[model samples]
Target: MSLPVHLVPALDGVVVGSTVTVEGDEAHHAVAVRRLRVGESVVLTDGAGTSVTAEVASTGKRVFTAVAADVRRVAAPAPAVVVVQALPKGDRGELAVEVLTEVGVARVVPWAAARSVAVWKGERAAKSLAKWRSTAREAAKQARRPWFPEVDELASTADVVAMLSTASLAVVLHEEASVPLASLALPADGPLVVVVGPEGGLTEEEVAAFTAAGASSVRLGAEVLRTSTAGVAAVAALLARTPRWG
Candidate 1:
């Protein structure tokens, strides 16, 4: 099995034979839950492209120390994929975030689309955003990703348009679109934006606005997919065409 990976703070300047401490709840989970013991190996990542392979050296009640055996730094994947996911009703939002992170999306931005069934307000908004962030973190760990995806604060349609306007390549998934996603040529570098509408789907105005801002409207296939899965499917299709997936 692959070594278990844990998220940690920055590991810059760390070298072989250096000792690093895994502490607090993270360490507790490793020692008490995973039962990580001395001499076993584990991977620790800063979630910003650096990872370390270490051998567990000692354990305490709420902390553990490891001797770093090797360190690796990965360049950020290109082109960076940013998914703008419309808020879905119920817990599907978390599901969407989890899958997008697992699929290697660089960032996931929750969009308040015109046809969204859910509303984020006050405490609910704060809680929902937190849940999405937490979901992304855990999903990244589960996927054994050294570079975790960022979950941005909820965005408005206008905000999304402005964001995509600056992207090197942008595509909006629409069931009504004539263009196929696979037919589009993805850029080798820079940002790639993918927009997935909510359960009720994107309004004509929203589609027009995004397209006007340089995003190409495209269809994944004949069958429609849930907002929770559409972004993941579209991203997989896009990545397969890029060297990032190879």
Candidate 2:
């Protein structure tokens, strides 16, 4: 089995036989909750493409030390994918963030669409963003990803348009669109952005705006996926055609 992975702030200068200390909540989880003991091994990642396989050297109340036996710095994935995911009600937002992270999206931008059933404002907005971010972080660890995906702050429709303008390729998931997502030529590098609407669907004005800003309105297929799932599905399809999945 893969050793339990813990996130660290940084793994700088770590090399073979280097000593690294893990502390606070992360170490407490490994030592107290995971029952990690000296001589056992664990994987530590900075979530920025740096990771180390280290054997535990010592354990304290809320801290531990490990000796790195291996270290790796991976390059980020090519053809980075950025998803403009409209807000979904309840826990679906978290579900979307989790699966999107697991599927290797480079970034997820939470959009407040015109027809969105749930609204994020005041304290709720902060809490919801935190949940999405936390879900992505945990899912990234579960996927053993060297680079964790980012969950951007809630975005306005205008903000999304500004984003689409510079994308290498941008597609808005529209059920009525004639163009299928798979038919589009994939970019070899740079940003490939996919926009997913909310439960009630995208308004005509929203569609026009996105298209005007350089996004192609495309369909996945005959079946319509839920707001929380459509982004990952589209991303999976898009990545399958790119060098990242190849």
Candidate 3:
């Protein structure tokens, strides 16, 4: 449908065919940024699966109204891909999150690797998390994704291993590994978590820890990739191999 689209926080009990008012930031975006006019169509998403296609009925400074044309409930991709990325130096981590979000990753975890140059400690950790969260939200909107990927707080190797232990398939990217990522067969259902190390790569202890947690240490390719690039590349490869995204 040819309409200006925006995502908003969901209101309770709102359903298909219901006429509703768009308020707050979304309304401002529609009225100011998009310059939407009465009779123009727009799509409003709740970012929790529901997207409502509507035509604008009125527009004002504080509110905008629309008549719902259709509502669609989108199901998240199967075998949800979660990237546990080691915090890269400078803005590379931020860039990695943005790229992964665009690549349709379901969730992201910031890992503090043994050799990580960028550290997220104390209040800095909070700020970093917030930054990544904002990046994910913006990327989701720009990519027209119905749902937003979560940006988790910085975690240590042990913490990440514990988290991924619950996944159906958890793989750690290691340069020395002989098993190719494509060779590792993953379950069609359940989650897939890929842990990527820092520029210096994962320490021997970290690799052993992940392997002990049921994660297979797999090599991405013959050539080594940087910390930020590995997670996104591995995720894309996995997604292509999976039945759902393939």
lDDT of 1: 0.94
Ranking the candidates on lDDT from highest down gives: 2, 1, 3
- In Å, residue 159's CA in model 2 sits off its true spot by 0.4
Which candidate achieves the best lDDT against the true structure?
Answer: 2
In angstroms, give how far residue 109 of model 3 lies from its true place. 0.8
Candidate 3 residue spans exceeding 4 A from truth: 1-3
State TM-scores per candidate: 0.97, 0.98, 0.92
Report the lDDT tens digits of candidate 3 across residue range 96-201. Answer: 9999999989999998898999988889989989989988887887787877898887787878979878999999999999999999887968689999999988
Q: Could you give me the TM-score of model 2 versus the true structure?
A: 0.98
CA lDDT scores, all candidates in order: 0.94, 0.94, 0.86
Counted clashes in each candidate structure: 0, 0, 0
Quantify how close model 2 is to the true structure by its C-alpha RMSD in Å: 0.8
Error at 183, model 2, angstroms: 0.8
Report the CA-based lDDT of candidate 2 relative to the real structure: 0.94
lDDT of 2 by residue, 1-246 (tens): 988999999998889999999999989988999999999999999999998999999999999999999999999998899999999998999999999999999999999999999999999999999999989999999999999998999999999999999999999999999999999987667799999999999999999999999999999999999999999999999888877778
Which residue pairs overlap in candidate 3's backbone? none
Alpha carbon lDDT at 237, candidate 2: 95
Error of 2 at 70 (Å): 0.2
83 in model 2: Cα distance from truth in Å? 0.8
Better of 2 and 3 by lDDT: 2
lDDT of 1 at 238: 87
